[model samples]
Target: MSTPSQLSTNADLRILQRNMAAALMQPLTRHDGLQSRTQVDFITPNDRLSGFQRLEIYARQYWFRLLDCLYDDYPALRVLLGEMRFHKLCRDYLAAHPSTSWTLRNLGSQLSAFITEPKARDVARVEWAQTLAFDEPQKKTLHIDDLLGADPSALRLGLQPCVIALRIDHAVDHFITAMKKTDADVRSGASQAMSQAPTRAAIIKAPRLKKEVLHLVIHRHENTLYFKRLTREAFLMLTALRDGLTLADAVELALAEADPTTDWPVQIRDWFAEWSQLGWFCKPSPQP
Candidate 1:
């Protein structure tokens, strides 16, 4: 029923698909030309466009779509690296780590590891955590009443799925917050030409973030994301609980490295109440 040219086996089809995929994923030439490949085998040349040009359309679109996703995911990283550098970063990062996941949400999952600059790396890490926190599904949160009369020594607790804890050497959170505010203000000021100019200037003249050890919890509540700063001990305790340690043991481990002069008992109670209200705690699934 089929001619020889139209006939195909599984192997033939697989080779065709592989060739097309390679063409789409290959990097564009310096002048935005397609790299040398055997596109003519499968692609037909036309009067207006050659076979390679036709393939280049899809390749450029594919790459542009991916680059746009990285821009959306890592706005702060772009700001830190500047526009041109960010573009280079995206190309280099993609070359090293292509999109393997079905969803673009995981595209920048390895970006932090790829970045070499400490400041930029820290920003990338925070931005990536925010992305994850925004997308992660929320679970039933543990309220203060749920913990009443519970045995601290034996009861293990879980953190909300959206909670992401980070300890960084610089106040990158503050820097990002400032950047976001500036962006919002610039957008608002766009209506008033007089205000827009200064707002844009503020972004270029943004102050450098001071180097400090910051413990932060990025969490989402009621569909809004928040960054909550924590004391070193509280950070340790919360991370410990997230690691499946019982409350008493977690507290003990947290306090072990804390300042000796501080009244940790009162602090612990206060931290628990605050975190409970924030709905950061959840009940872990029982092990088999």
Candidate 2:
């Protein structure tokens, strides 16, 4: 029973809906789809409300939704930057890398990379690293005896599923600790006016180890990712061993860095046992 005019009105309104939906989900601008004025002004209802007035609702929501995604991904960064600076950073990020992602989680994948740009090249990597550090799911506690049956020198454990190696241009631990605070913008100590300043050594999830924290590597075995810190000697020894060097060759690699008078065989035996218990070695399948 509708007239031609009524049919035309329905068509125009449908087009408006299509245009608004596109604008909402992507980093589209007012002019990207239909002329903003056309969608805003050509309404079917003979009401006082203008078309632009109604479409403004969609426009505002678009910005709000995008900001929400960014907030979830970089809460620590937001805390450090404070409300005003953080919002500004978000705007800059949007301008540089519009909302092309369909899901919220992937929005921040480029954040650390984006920080390398002239606008944010400084705080980007470290901040992004802190947020993503917890993104990987952790495993359950594995008892030390879990690998007891395995021979000590035959297995080689690798990084856990929850661990990701990152090399932030900025020191990671300092950035995380600083952001973990309530204030966010308060820099660590008087020395940190700039990020390049001398900083604390790198350590992650250190508090969980329940002992003195220093440098070392982490890996998964028996449903848990265990950490084995290396002294310079330990790291050198392990690195040498990983390079296909024999036990003696590995010990020689570590000796120069160890206390000048340390015993070689004793250290190697202890290293072999500890490494074996940690699933750092596996037996060669007995000759067929």
List all candidate RMSDs to the true structure: 6.7, 12.3
Q: What tens digits encode model 1's per-residue C-alpha lDDT throughout 175-205?
A: 8887763221111111211211011121244
Q: How accurate is candidate 2 locally (lDDT)?
A: 0.48
Q: In model 1, which runs have C-alpha deviations exceeding 4 angstroms? A: 1-7, 37-40, 181-207
lDDT of 1 at 115: 92
In order, what lDDT does every prediction score? Answer: 0.78, 0.48
Summed over model 1, clashes come to 0
Q: List runs of model 2 lying over 4 Å from the truth.
A: 1-18, 25-48, 75-85, 95-103, 117-123, 130-135, 140-143, 148-158, 182-288
Per-residue alpha-carbon lDDT of candidate 2 for residues 119-194, written as tens digits (9 for 90 to 100): 2333454344334333444434233355457453554333223333332233334443444532223222232122
lDDT (Cα, 0-100) at 239 in candidate 2:
62
Candidate 1 RMSD to the correct structure: 6.7
- Residue-pair clashes, model 2: 10
What is the TM-score (0 to 1) of candidate 2?
0.48
